[model samples]
Target chain A: MNNALADKALWDLRPGEAATVTGFGDALSVSYQGRVMEFGFQPGTRVQCLLNPGFGAPRVYGISNSVFSLDKEIAAAVFVTTRPPQEASS
Target chain B: MRRVLLLGSPNSGKSSLFNRLTGLSQRVANYPGITVDVASGPMVNLPDTELVDFPGTYSLEPISGEEAIAVSFLNEALADDHVSHVLCVADATRLEKCLHFILQVIRECQHHQKPVTILANMSDVIRDNQLQFDPAGLAAALGVPVISVSAKESQGFEPLVECPAEGAAPATPPSRNWRETPNEILRGTAQQLAAQFSPKGDVLINSQLRLDRFFLSTALGGLAFFFIMFLFFQSIFTWSAPVMDAVEALVSGLGEAVVPLIPNRVIADFVADALFGGVGAFLVFVPQIFVLTLVIGIMEDSGYLARAALICHRPLRVFGLTGKSFIPLLSGVACAIPAIYAARSVDSPRQRMMTYLAIPLMPCSARLPVYALLIATFISNDTILFGLVGWQGLALFFIYFFGMLVALLVTGLVSKASKNKHSEQPFVLELPPYRLPTAKPLLRNAWNRCRQFVTQAGKIILAVTMVVWVLGYFPNGGADLGESWLGTLGQFVEPVFAPLGLDWRYGIAILTSFLAREVFVGTLGTIFGIEGSEENMLPLVDHIQASGLPLGSGIALLVFFAVALQCVSTVVILAREGSTRLALSMLLSYLVGAYLLSLIAFQIVSLLF
Candidate 1:
């Protein structure tokens, strides 16, 4: 239960699993599932891991980095929690 | 002024984001029919900036029926002067799928010289997953400033929000030769791409994402349809309730205040009956109508209405029309005029006529008052049996179910003889990438519809009410309303339905409802001669329950309204779409169906209950 997978892991990392973040911020490539655009989530976003990350184009097409984008003005209403506090991060 | 677009694939959480950004700053349409307003919302920009939330789509390449709109929009904009700043929002988890669209948009926008940026939204989600993002690598490759942010968390706003748009352009590819058939080009490309990338072998074996699959597409389409429809119906009831009551009170007070000013008994009654019961009644229902139109406007602007037409196609086709014909049927539930015009999307002439003919069978809002009133009086609060079938408030649901079923039955019957039969146009739509839904487009759509409904239905209902009033007015000047020509006309018809257990009041309500279903309850309210209205519908029904009319007659009235073509506007749609003969047949068929169903239902229920 501990390598301590996070909520972002649920989007990019698998349940009861973990992955390392090598870099801080390079606008994560926004894309889709089959054709998903996983850019709806803001910076310091959480994503889950699909397959062991080595499957098909994982970086380009994984549910690991999930986010929803609304119409331009509508996107502003969203309030993302800044990277969860170390104690509160699950 | 500044401009930007929010774009991403379906269910990528784009719509939820839009709701949060603009809360009630939107207006439903103030105009109708001719031009559709898509980009019409204001966002508070830092000092000064403009935001445009484009429709959602899978890729610039068209995929599903609804998604096709984005492709066409992009293509059309390429030809026209229309252009805006682009924010290509990609999901952190599904970057590959999202990149294709981003690449396509970049390639196109760069070619058009439109300013654009890339947003890797849902950074919080990526952070939660312990995901790493290389902005330098992506920025170098796509040639657009990449900023990762979350629409839900609103993170990464400092750098990306209100940031200056990069003037550097993207590299473009050669255009295709259109003189050659589109199919010929598709065939050639399919053969070419087959050689470079392995369409098979290990790549195919490890493929987790199926770009060429139907399951994913259909699931997205269905989910969008369900979510949008669920929100629409819920909003209609919740948003409109308070406003509707306020409207009712305004007109009711006016009617009472004006009543004492008139001198003669007949004139005093006429002012209350004709004005309050006519125009006043119509105004009372406006709030519900406005709310329904606003929800519909949002669905239309977001480009989901086309998806609904696509999803509801199969079920509607069972009634003899294709997916293209489904909107008219759904709109028929709202009101019929728009439903008929909506039938224009159906290419098959016979299908259009059949849809127009059958739309009247569906109960509209006008009929709701009639059904509610009738159900209250005859159906009893308690359950009754109908020849092994249990009838309760459940009978109410069947009334609608029966209308939909009859539409199918009629369409099926008509389709058999149609020489115009054709295969369904496979619903290949471009699911517009999710974007913030704005208020301007929603408002414009609502207001336009309001003007259309008011001008169209208003005049017809008013003219008819006046004519009806005149008919009951002169000669002896209706010494007693019961003695008027209209009253005598109603009482004369009462005996014909006596077998179903109705009296003269029931006859009057039915006759008046033909003008518009809103009048049915009003006619009854006036007939009972009640002073001051009850917010509750039950008290009136309680009185009817005590009246001599049998339970069977009450139930019969409901069933008839449920299945009958009571709304005249629906008949107008039929005539306008096809011919006088066609409209007449639609009317005849519904009247006959109504009589037969209610007769059988009443007879069976009377014996059993």
Candidate 2:
């Protein structure tokens, strides 16, 4: 995880755990996987963990009315500050 | 002429509004990736106005190839003064999320001095939920006309059409750095706006979350996906069979009744053999085409296809295709022409090219008639294994499976050889909330697709059938086909297929079939003096069975058609969509591969039998 995320990776987020995006880690940088940014993954976004495929694979996250599934490696690159479970209204 | 550009995020009901405004039955699906190309038609009520529907995109920044297309089109429209207005469509149910794109549209319009309007689509959802949409507040904030309309229910469109033609430029340009805008800021602003409009926030999200808990679950979702696919393919066979039978019987009955009416013997033979035997053979597959399109349309409109793609992505990635490739590949089973067009949704050019290479190998509807005829002719219907599975059904399933396997193998090989394999895009797709599909659009789209397939393929099929009929009817005037001009041509190619234990007649059929795979059955029927209809299929089967062709050769023919790129329309689509080089290379490689593999299968089976 990026140092800016306080060592938090998005893949570690559980369902109903809301988080505020800090910045893209090395993998999701424009020089690397630019699509991560294109998919509305910019900083200060609120994302709630929706579902995990349950095989140590990708997990689905709901952010700004869009549901996106990201693999473990790419999910790990999305650094965020975890919001308390109570903050997730849905 | 007034040109109005309609823009929206995917699945925002943008297409429905276009359909309503233009009175055109444009394809409206529940998923995000349906409209890859722009569809344009004149507005129904406004004769001087034209509406263009663009592919949905999340942002102006280009991530995928389709998004790039959308972004460039918007840029072009902004620069061009002839475009009178830009209409940004937003989903009323998901207003908070949709505002992100709408804001970008407003900013871009401001910079270009183009007038913009916000079309609040899906107002019926708001009405059903008893929620409010404050068009006045939204209008004040955006400094543009905000129109709330239900494109599906056909309400609130009058305000849209009655709006003035002269687009007033914004008095003050809104200055916001789109690239640097924080997602939290946009989400918060959108939420505040939504709250201002509706007293309750998150009403839609809560409903969606309750459903997603089960639909997005790991095991249940996977099981449901497979079950749906199995039911879909099986229904294509079972549901379409009766309709197919009816069509076949009608064609044969017509041929029998009409052939004797012609006074000239040669013309009579031509009418029966060429027109009825040739073109009629291809018409039987139309029912299957309708069934395939209808099923796919429902799956798309119900929002299940996106989930299926999500599940298949992991498996498809292993084969060098993205989960996005699934829709197009499945569509290929119905027809390769539209499948090639659908492939434009794939983000990566390399993967798209690989997909094109695999599409022709799909056991399309064109191959179904040939497969049925061959399987019925060679394999006994009573040859049941385990007393539960009929040999015929099993053979059909195996052929489809075989084609899919070859498609995957070819895609994998091409990916391995591709130069940009290292820099592949990450798999990212948006899953929309589930909605019940309407029957009106489903049947209409299905009918439109069936019509498209027939009209596009009809000309080529007819011309080829006529030419084959002429060659066979000439040089001897209804004498033995063995001494006819077609026989001379068939003899020339006989040695090529002789290794497969086929005679000159079969060679002639194979040659004619190059125009379209279904023509194989028609040419064979004509050569054997039978109309290519369902009633005559059994007689053709009997003739082939008694003709002394080895069992191995029959299986060889089946295997060959299953693997080959035999359809001219498929090749034409490949050339048009991708490149002539790609199409030519695919044709050459598959032709060689089909011949060699069939040869090996024939030789081994001959030895065993």
Candidate 3:
């Protein structure tokens, strides 16, 4: 419920930036939320943006040791808090 | 027989492990959802025990058709009395991402009172990447026996095979509290276990990211994809031409030597015309099928297919399809039977139906011989562009492109016409780490595909050829084809194809092709051989050219074949996968559409030239 953290979505992070998932946006339907969670997007899990192929294509993200390509709309529905740039080195 | 179920998330090496234990090659690949059905075989060492491999699933909550198959099968297998143990496979390198599924499987086993063991696959990958993982520690935490096994290197099988023979105990009694944990808490528990015992670094992800930087880049990725596709289409013609010619020569030589050995005139004519002329023509195209399957198998095993799907999402979405549809559509190029099976991975029902509509239009290999004969007869085979390209190969490429364009157009029009306003499921796909493709399994798979193509299509083509030969041979003893029964029947349907400038001979080939598309080539071969030719040994293409068929008619035939749903097997599979009504409607509509378009093509060509 923190104002600054709630303002950011996973889609806002650029390449090399890491973030901790807070929760899903209200825009996502309940069933869709469950589907996303089953794909390892639960709250408190760390996710890093790896690549954003330009021209409005899906961007690549690394969660744990696995990589998944998610389109823009789905990426925008997951809320996250970006880590400090220096602390995101790993 | 005692049954042990093998279950895991997609691309987790479950199929590979099954192959290793049971010694049955079940088509393992790096792409997800390749194993769309359940397969079982007796274990190699323990013949009394059966190993069952289910299609991969993310969780018991099904999202796609294939996953639904896996979940429903699990429920049935668990309730059955013959089932004894469950071996849950997890990717050792991606333990944290895999643990949630493993926990769900464990909980399900507890509910059914079945014993479960965890087999952590890809331990060799962890070692090669210079990472650490403690299988013993993970086993203690989950209170289930965990063994690290590498299906790639055949490592750690000694312990894996022994667990089942000892009658594995129901995952320890002391962890009853852990077994009863709710689903919400199980997610956190999976993370905790992975953090404590799994490999701890970004080395694997970093390596995969380096490759994705080039393969998933905006400009470079598009250029690379087009280049690879061009090579793929070009090689289908260039690589297989020599083998095709060798097959043609061998069949004809054997016919010439053996046909004269039979002194009776009737039997000699049958062997020469039916066996050598009809079935032999279809055999020449088998090498092309093998080459096509090999290249597609290479792409699937190297993990480039997923990257290609990502690159295609934007363009495909415009046609009411998702990136996942790219796999099935491309598979359609080889054959429609497996391509229809591949559509189970698409999550949305509407999008999957759209994909089914588009799949039959993709230029499958069965149509390759028909197009090749037409092109060879009409277009000169001379090389152009400073000898860098062949005219015939370029024609093949353009024909393939035209078929794909029509598919996209039809799907786009359907999308615009439908009144449904519901939102589609999101596009989320996993990109497995790129690996160098091994040559052995790929060659074996391609060989198996060739054998399958021959056996499945061979029976139909042979029967149709025999019927055509017998009907054309009688009534005048091969003296006048016009007096034959097939000739009279063909003339009956000749009016249907007359607008395209085709005669009764072409009419008969088109009619019989409904049994199978490649039969078109074989039928033509049989007809031309019977119609009083001293040089009947000439290849079908030469015979076609010598007949002086108009260029307009040849081009019209190409267009007709591109649009028609001629294969009965494709229609049957479509009916089973979709609905009987949907399949029949598609069959009728495409037949009408093909005739109209070909009429237009014939008119346009005649006017311009």
lDDT scores of the candidates, listed in order: 0.55, 0.74, 0.79
**Which lDDT tens digits does candidate 1 get at residues B447-474?**
6656656675677667776778876675
Residue pairs clashing in model 3 are none
Please give, for residues B1-609, the per-residue lDDT of candidate 2 as tens digits. 878889998888887788788887354322332334566767777768778787777677665565676687678877987788888898876665567677778778767767788888878888887876777677776667788889888997765674524554332234334434554455456545654553245566677777766776777777777788788767676788899889988998999999988999988888897678767766776787787777777877787777777777788877788777887887788778767866766767777887788888888888888899988987778755567888888888998899889899988877777646354667667677788887776677667766766775667667877887788778888576667787898899899999999899998888777778877886777777887453368878877888888888888998899888987767766866677798898888998899998999899999998
Arrange candidates, best lDDT first: 3, 2, 1
DockQ of 3: 0.65
Please give, as one word, the docking class of candidate 2.
Answer: acceptable
The predicted structure with the larger DockQ, 1 or 2, is 2
Minimum summed lDDT over a 10-residue window in model 2 chain A is located at: A81-90
Pick the winner on TM-score between candidates 1 and 2: 2
Query: Per-prediction DockQ, in order?
Result: 0.05, 0.40, 0.65
Q: Which prediction has the highest lDDT against the true structure?
A: 3
Residue B311, model 1, lDDT: 52
Per residue, candidate 3 scores C-alpha lDDT tens digits across B1-609 of 988889988778886788788877453322233324466778878778888887777777776555675687688889987888899999998887688788888888888888888889999998898889888778777878788899899888886676674567533433544567787788778767766776888998998999899888888988998888777766676787799889989999999999999999888988898789778877776787677777777786788878887888888999988887987897688667667756765767788899999999999988887888788888888998999999989988988998899999999999878836353667888888887876776786677767765675577667777887788788777765556787787899899888998889898888767756877776687688643222332377787777877888998999989999998767866876677798899899889988888899899999988
Chain A TM-score values for every predicted structure, listed in order: 0.24, 0.77, 0.82
What candidate 1 gets wrong by more than 4 Å, as runs, is: A1-90, B1-227, B253-272, B324-354, B380-391, B417-420, B423-430, B476-479, B528-543, B572-584, B606-609
